[model samples]
Target: MAKGKLVGKKLILLGERDGIPGPVMEACLKDSGADIVFSVTECFV
Candidate 1:
């Protein structure tokens, strides 16, 4: 992803268990200059 694309923004990530997890997504976006409100990993099975 482009750096700082989410700069000065707030994020609420909803991730999947089989796909990218919340923490992983959070890590990837950590350098995006965004404030993560929360990250949730949901399981659908």
Candidate 2:
């Protein structure tokens, strides 16, 4: 398995209810070994 390059890096994801990166972001998280920490989303108002 390829070791994560961001093992100690911090990651944050901010998305809208209809964001464009939902799937891609998920894939990144799955492949990441970094401390995948927090996520926040807000509805378009």
- The TM-score leader among the candidates is 1
Separately for all candidates shown, the number of backbone clashes (residues 3 or more apart, or on different chains) is: 0, 0
Kindly provide the TM-score of model 1 when superposed on the true structure, using C-alpha atoms: 0.83
- For 1-45, candidate 1 gives per-residue lDDT tens digits of 446568889999999999999999999888888999999999989
Tens digit of per-residue lDDT, candidate 2, span 1-45:
437677677777766777744445656676666655666666777
What's the lDDT for all of these models? 0.91, 0.65
TM-score against truth, every candidate:
0.83, 0.51
Candidate 2's C-alpha lDDT?
0.65
Clashing pairs in 2: none
Q: Please report the TM-score between candidate 2 and the true structure.
A: 0.51
Q: What is every candidate's alpha-carbon RMSD to the true fold?
A: 2.9, 2.9
Weakest lDDT window of 10 consecutive positions for candidate 1? 1-10
